[model samples]
Target: MIEAFDLFSVEQVAFGTGRWEQLGGFARRLGSRSLLVTNAGDPGDGGLVDRTLRHLEQSGVAATCFRQRGEPRVEDVERAVAAAREQGCDLVVALGGGSAIDAGKAVAGLLTNGGSVLDYMEVIGQGRKLTRPATPWIAVPTTAGTGAEVTRNAVIGCPEKRFKASLRSELLLPRIALIDPSLAVGVPPHVTACSGMDALCQLIESFTSNRAQPLTDAWALHGIRLAARALPRAVAAGDDVEARTQMALAAVISGVALTNVGLGAVHGFAAPAGANYPIPHGAVCARLLPPVIEANVAALHAEDRDHPGLAKYAEIGRALTGTCDAASDAIEAGIGCLNDLVDQLQIPPLRQFGLTPEGFADLVSLARKASSMRYNPVTLSDAALTEILQKAW
Candidate 1:
C-alpha cells in the first residue's frame, strides 16, 4: 500500500534581532484572551515573558500565564488546558524552548475537544485521534532547536508506559510560528549544544528516513549544510548573529523535514531513553547518532555490500560533512562530529542518568517497541541493538 506524505508549514515567521515587539499586533490579531504558555521558573526567561505580557496587555488582550518547567508530561498539558479553560482563554501562545511549545500544543489541542490528554497520547494511552479543531495557537520559539514551532508532532512521555510517544495530527500544527533570533541569544552553552544537536539529528535522520519525499529531502539536505557550517559556531558564541541566524533557520527547516519524512533509529532509541532515563532527548540522540550510523553502515557493508540503507547513509554523510571519503571514514567523521559537540559542551554519559550497561540491557526491549525504530532502513537484531548501546557507552 502506498502512504501519502503530507506537507505542513509555518503560517508566519518573524525572525530578527529584536522582533518581540511585533508580537503585540500579531497577538491581537489572534484573539483578545491569550493563554501565555511559558517555561517554568527560568530566571532568564522572566524578562522575555514580561516583555511579551506587556505587549499583550497593552494590546488590550487579557492574558493568563501557564509556566511549564521540564519536558512536559501528559499531566502538565492537562493542567495548562484546565487553567486556560478556567481563564476562558481564546488562544494559546507558546513562548520558550521545545518543551514549553509542546505543552502549548497539547493545551491548544485539548481546549476545544475536552478529552483526557492521555486519551490522545502516543503508545501509552488509547492513542485516540483528535478530530476537533484546536484553540487558535501562536508559537513563539525561544531556542534554535526542535523547530517545535512548525512541527505537527508533539512528543510527550508517559511515565506509566515507560515509553515515549507523539501526539501527531495536522490539526495540532500551530496556527502561526514566531521565530525570533534574539530570543536564542542568552541561551546557555549547554543548551546551545544540546538543542543544536537536536536540529542536526533531525536533518540527518529525516534525509535518511525510509519514507523520504522529494520536498522533505530538499529541506533536509539544506538543513544539514546549514548545521555543518553554523551549529558549532553558534554553540561557541551565542551572540554571533550570522551563526545564530543560520542555525535558527536550520532548526526550522529540519523541523519541516522531520515532520514530512519522519525520523530514524536515533530518535527511536532516544525516546525510550528519555522516558526511562533522566538524560535529555538531544543529548541521548547526540550520543547515539554516530554509533547507530556506524552500526547501520557496517551491517550494510559486511554483508557483501547488499544492505538496503546504504543510499540514505551516503546521502546524509555527503550532505552534512561533504565528500564521502570512504564509507568507514564518512561514518567515523559523523561519530567524530558528535564527540566534538559533546566535548565542546561537556554533556554527560548515559550512566549519569543511572543507565548502566545493565540498565541499558532493558533498553533493547524499550528500543524495539519505539515507533521511530520502525523507520530504520535495516531491521537490527537484539544483538545489534546491544552493540549500538555498547558503542554509544
Candidate 2:
C-alpha cells in the first residue's frame, strides 16, 4: 500500500538565465500597484532593486520599495503592512534574498488578513490560522539559498521572546516564483559557501525526516546530489554559471522537500542560535549540520529497536560519497564526508561566534521547543543535544 501524502507549490514558477526580464509581466497580471521589498544594498553596487523597479514601471505597474537590512522581525513586518496599506499597494514583490521574501510574505498576508504577524506565528503566539487569502505575491530570489520564493512559511525573529518562529499558511505561498539563477553570480564566496551548506543540510534532513514520503524523497535525493557537486564549485569560482544554476535549482528543491517533510536537529538549533546571537542563519546551519548528522547516526545505533530512517542515512552516504557499502558502513562514510566538506568550506566553530556555556544552555532549552525537532529521525536526549553542540564548538 502506498503511504498518503500531499504536495503544495506556488501557482506559477519560471527558472532560467534571463527570467528577470519577465518580472514586469508577472507583476502587471497581479495588480496595477506593487510594493517591492528588498535588502538595503544599492543597485549601483550590484543590487537588483533598481532593475526590478524598472521592470514593474515599464509594465505600467506603480511601485514603491521597502528596504530591509537584516532578518525579518515581527516589527518589520508590522511596519511594512501598514506602509503598504497606507500607500494603497495591491500586490507584493520580493526582490532580494530570503529575508526580503519573508518580509513581503508577511506583508501580503497581513494586508488582507488584518492582524499583527505575531497573531498567526507559531510557538509564541495564538497560532491562529489565516482565514483570508493573501494579496498576490511575486518572489524574485537574487540568492541561491533559503528557497523562500516557493515556501508557504516566513520565519520571523521575535525579539521579545528571543525566538525565531515561522508565520505559516498555505495562502502565503507566492503567486509566482521568478527564479533567475544568473542573478546569483554576484554573491560573495563566503556567502555562497554558507548558503550552499544550508541547502545541503535541508536536503539531508528532509530525506531522513520522520515525515518524509515518496514524493519528498525524490526531490531531496536530486537536491542532495546537485548540491554536493555544485556547492564546492560555486564557492571556489563564483562566476561559474553551471554551478550557480545547479545550486539554485537544489535550493528550491530543498525548500519544497522540507516544506512537505520538515527538517531536523540542525535547523532546530540554528533557529534559536540566530535569535540569541547576531550570527547569520546560513552560518549557524553550516556549523551545526555535521555534528547533527553524527549525533543522529550514533543515536540510531544505540536504540534497541530498528528505526526505518536509520537505513536512509546510509542511502545519503552512498549518494553523497559515490560509494557502495553496507548500510552501517556507508552511514559512517557519509558522516566522514560531511565533516570533510564542512571543514573544506571553512565553516567556523560555534565558539568562534561567541557562544558561551550559558548561551548554549539557553539554546538547548529553546531548541527543545522548536518545531523542527518534531521531524527528527531519532528523538535525541538532552545529553545527546549537548554533545552535538560541544562537538560543533
Candidate 3:
C-alpha cells in the first residue's frame, strides 16, 4: 500500500519552443508594470533580455530591469524589492539562470510581506511564515537547470554569516513558469554539463529519499531517464534543440519531484559547501554525486538491507545504464556511469575548489543540520559522511 503524500507546484506552466513570445501577455494579465530580473552580466545587446523587454513593451507593460550578480544574496533581494516598490511595479519576471529566478522569488515574496529577508529565511533568521500572497511573478529560465521557476523556496546567501539558507513559503511559487528550450541554445558547454548533472543528481537523490511518494517516484524515474539520454548531447552540441528540450523538461520535473518529496545527501552537502566556498552550486553537486551515491549504498547495505532505497538505486542504475541485470550489478553499473559522465563533462574535483581534509569536520557537522539531510535514505554517520567528502575531494 502506498503511504499518504503531498505535492506542491507552480500555479501554471507554459512550456514549448515558442512559449517565450507569450511572456508579454502573461505579464499583462498580472500587472501593467513589471520588475524584470536578469543576470548582472547580461548586457542586453539585443540578447534574451532585450527580447524580453520588447515583448513586455509590445503588450503595453512597462518594465524596470534588476540585474542579480550571483546567487541570490539577502542584500540583492532587498535592493530589488526596493526598486520594485519605487517603480510601483506590480509584477515580477525573472529571466536568466537559477540565481536570477531565486532573487526575483525573494523580492516578490518580500514585497507583500513587508519585512527584511531575514524575517522569513530559515536556519539563519527569524523563520517567520509569509502571511500574505507574493506579488505576481513569472519565471523564464534561460538555462535548462535548477527549475527554480517552479519551486517555492529561494536560496539566499549571507556572506557575513558564511552560510546559505532558504526563504521558504508556498506564496513564493511563481504565478507562471515559462520555459522555452530555444532560450537555452548557445549556453556554454561547461554550464550545460554542470546544470545537467545537477538535474540528474536531484532526480536520483529524490527518488531515493525517505519522503518519496508514488507521484514523485514516477516523476523522478522519468526525469532520470531523460537526463541520462540528453545530458551528453546537450553538452556536446549546445544548439541541439531536441537535447535542450529534453533537458529542460527533465529539470522541471526534477524541481517538482524534489519540492514535494525532498532530496538526499548530495543536496545536504551542497547547502553548506556552496555557502562557504566560491564553487558554483551545480558544480559542487556534480563533484559529490558519485561519492554520495556510493556512501548511501554502502550504508544501506551494511545496516538496513531491506530499505526501499536499495531497490530504488538499482532502478536508477538501470535508468542510467539501460541494463537488466541483478540489483547489485545494476547499482554498481549505475555508479560507474555517473563517474564516467563526470569525467566526460570535466567536472572538477572538490579539492580544486579549495576544500581540504581539515574542513571535513565542519562540513559534516553543518551538513547534519541541513534540512535536506533529514530526507536521506539512511542515517549516515560522521565517519561515512567524512569518507564521502574525502573521496569527492
Q: Which predicted model would earn the best TM-score? A: 3
Off by over 4 Å in 3: 40-44
- By lDDT, the best candidate is 3
Clashing pairs in 3: none
Which tens-of-lDDT digit does each residue in 1-393 have in candidate 2?
668999998988899988889988888888999988888365555456777777789999998888876999999998888889888999999888889989999899989999788899999888999988899989988888898888889999998999999989999999999999988888898889888888899899999998998988988888888898899999999989999999999999988988888999999998899998887788889778878988888888788435667789989998888889998888889888888888898888888888987776778889999999999988999988988889888
Off by over 4 Å in 1: 1-5, 40-46, 302-308, 324-329
User: Candidate 2 regions off by >4 Å?
Assistant: 43-46, 304-306
Stronger candidate by TM-score (2 vs 3): 3
Residue-level lDDT tens digits of model 1 in 1-393: 445777777666666767777787888888889999998334336587877777899988888888897888888888898899898899999999999998899888888777888788767778899998788899988888898988888888778878778888888888778887878888887888888888988888887787877788887888888887787888888898788889888999988888877888888889889988888888888788878877777766776584546766766666667776666566566667667766666767666777888876689888877778887766777888888888777
lDDT by residue for model 3 over 66-88, one digit each (tens)? 98998888999999999999999
Which one wins by lDDT: 1 or 2?
2
Give TM per candidate.
0.93, 0.97, 0.98
